[model samples]
Target: MSSDVIVIGGGIAGLATAHELIRSGASVTILERSRCGLEASWAGAGILSPLLPWDYPQSVARLAQLSNSLFPEFIEALTTETGIDPEYQASGMLVLPELLPESSGDAKGLRQDARNQMAEDWCGRNAFPMTRVRSREIARALARDQEAFWLPGVCQVRNPRLLQALIRAVNLAGGKIVEHTAVAGLRVERGRTQSISTSQGDEYSADHYIVAAGPWSRQLLGEHALKLDIWPVRGQILLFKAQPGLLDTILLQEWDYFYLIPRHDGHILAGSTLEEAGFDKSPTTEARQILLAKAHALVPALTEETVSGHWAGLRPGSPANIPVIDRHPSISNLYLNSGHYRYGVTMAPGSARLLSNIILDKPQPVDVTPYQWPR
Candidate 1:
């Protein structure tokens, strides 16, 4: 099928791009190897902001900031259109740093504390309110022995529901989605993609193409030898069903690099190991144990609840953990919008908005030079 824009991959990036393009009066079609919105888009913990914003580079922070700002309106519109609540919550994040005794405020101890203090300073500089408070003030679920900082502006979404809403939004916007259809090969001619040859032995052509295939994006590009820095990093998460109000805020332990996320419906999610397992999405027992131990450490009451679910998804890891969201350097008609890694859900709206703007030659909101393909 021919269209104005053929988005390769039916994840949030592709669907959001298609939705924006359709709203701009462009005909769009999305091709997915499996069902849409079930990959990293669905499997993510859906913390709508970077787990630690100060830890990322400015390029990553810029897109994340814009996307975070855009999410409320975006999700609200999607909810209104699709009749699905994505469970968008400004639940805030409670970051627990290693506890240092008040008497021994040495340089090393202060250094560990400085990470949180730095994040608080960054939030203040950016006009976002962040407070360092005693651990017992927020929730009884956390370890009272630790020191914590609260970033109330940090939010989360139900990723699976968000994906469902996106799929419905795309459908409502008159965007065509072809599921269970893989692009076997790209037929490029004279430095341009003429059409994509599918596994079903059919050819689909479009005026322009976007590769937003997540973890598979780099592989697909390598199959066609297109230059894009994206690779698979496997992430595993554990879900525990607890009673409501068991956790009122998102709990983060920076020293351990693990988190406990509370859902509206009595489900708490403890995630994730960033493994370079080469497209393997298997959840290992080792990872499960590690996450479970961390979850219990964060909330002692969590040990009472049975594990509801554990799953893994491959994130598209990129160089410097920044996404490439610009036109392909060689192919004028091809655009790259993959390599979002852990921040896929956090950055989707801005990434899509940027890609759509680039496609339509509209003025961009932020500087695109940092996100461009390195020449």
Candidate 2:
């Protein structure tokens, strides 16, 4: 079918973009190779914060914070329209103190000495409410003997539920979604994308084209190759049946580079392993065990719970960890909203808004300079 805009990929980025475009009176069509929202968008744990901001670029942290601010109103409108609960919760995050070094050869003393020295270096570099605590203090807090330090602003959404809500919103908004339809190549004429050919040998054309194919964006762009350095970083998460009163807030073990998210349905989602395995979505037993051990070490109650599930997804990673959201330099009618990596779900609404502004020639809510089309 012909339309004003053809969006490739039906994950969160594509759906949100289509929703925004349609809301602005653009007739949009989404082409999904498989089921919409069943890939990275669905597999995501849905943490809305750039929890480890100290490790990311300023652009990423800014975008995440902006998106996090936009979520409340977004989810409210979505639930009102689709009657699906996005499960947006503002449950803060807790950073447990690391254990003391083992006393083998004065290691504990040496480690404390090192931290004392590093604390001086970290004084002005890090933010507030951060400190070096003894492992016994962390264990005591988990054991309810001491108070756990809280980072007040972390939040999360029910990701799979959010996708379902978006699907309903898209259909209800009069937008069309063509599932199992893979675009093999774009049909460009006179430097404009007029149509796209699917793997089934059918051609569908539109007035505008949007590529939000996540990790597969580079391949879909083909010889035209939009200078997107998007790479697939594989991450695996383990789900455990949550015990009552076990985890009240998200736990981020800063040094461990892992987190624990508590869901409304008594399930704790602990993830993830970041490996550059190149489009591989398989989960390894070793990874699972490592995650489980890490979870248990932080919250010992996890060992008593049962493993509910395990899965992996490919995050569309980039070198600078910022997404590309601009019109293609060569193809005027073509645009992109991909390479979001771990922040796709968090940045969805903001990214969609930015792309919509670009498409409609309206003023953007956030600066789109950093996410420009590659040179």
Candidate 3:
């Protein structure tokens, strides 16, 4: 049966958009190459914001803030619809500035003081709450006693649980989900999408089609993709089953682009190495050793024995971690909403809202110029 919209990709982007569409009174059918939510969306650490929100462009910040604001109601609705609670929490993030030590190692501290000043300025301008405090003041378990930035507005969610709830909620809302159906190509006629064909020689049609296929969006669109800068950047994460209370906050080392996120169930996720591996999701021993060294450096309790798992996922790497959430420049009935890089889950609801508004021809809350399909 044809659907009001055909979403090609069952990852967080696809699932979120379909759920939003269903909420907006549009029928949706999600076609996935494999099981939903088992991809990058599941493999993520579930941190609801960027490691350093101040480092990104204003466009990224707006989208993230919008999505973050919508998260409470989003999680509530999902929990009300499904029994799963996604474990949403205002678990703050602790930022450890990269320190540069002189030979004596006492005269020098806090590398990139200019960046910290920029961070402080940006936070003041944006009204984002942040405080400078000693690491030991907040996290007694930390190995060092350095000054850190305390961002209390940050949040976290069990992304796997969130995706599970989203899938269930969509199904309960009458949206269809078809797994293991890899969309091979789009059938376009007269500046609009007619149908999408799968590798199994079957076709699915919809009034409108969305290409949220994550890293594969540009390839799936082929010649139809005009100046869409999207590729796969592989990230590997390691899980350690440490005591839950050992770490109470999201610990981030901005210089190395590393973070350790704690869960309610005593599992701490240490990640991740952003490697330009190009679609290779295989975990490597070298990367694992590097991450373990970082985790051990901060919290000595996370040893090899406590290690539980290691896996990798390909992020839809974009130029500046900003996603396109607009209709195709020429194809009126087609849209694109991928290329969120590492912030897809963090930006899901806002991106979904933007795309749904574009589809429904409604007014947008934020400026839609930055996210327009590339000319």
Which residue pairs in candidate 2 collide? none
Please state the error at residue 203 of candidate 1 in Å.
0.2
- Winner by lDDT: 3
> Tell me, what's the RMSD of every candidate?
1.6, 3.6, 1.6
Candidate 1 residue spans exceeding 4 A from truth: 101-105, 223-227
Winner on lDDT between 2 and 3 is 3
**What would you estimate as the lDDT of candidate 3?**
0.92
TM-score of 3: 0.97
Q: Name the weakest run of 10 consecutive residues (lDDT summed) in model 1.
A: 221-230
For candidate 3, the clash count comes to: 0
Ordered from best to worst TM-score, the candidate numbers read 3, 1, 2
Q: Relative to the true structure, how large is the alpha-carbon lDDT of every model?
A: 0.86, 0.83, 0.92
Predicted candidate 3 versus true structure: per-residue lDDT over 81-130, tens digit per residue:
99999999998999998766666354343347777889999999988999
Q: After superposition, how far is residue 188 of candidate 1 from its true place, in Å?
A: 1.3
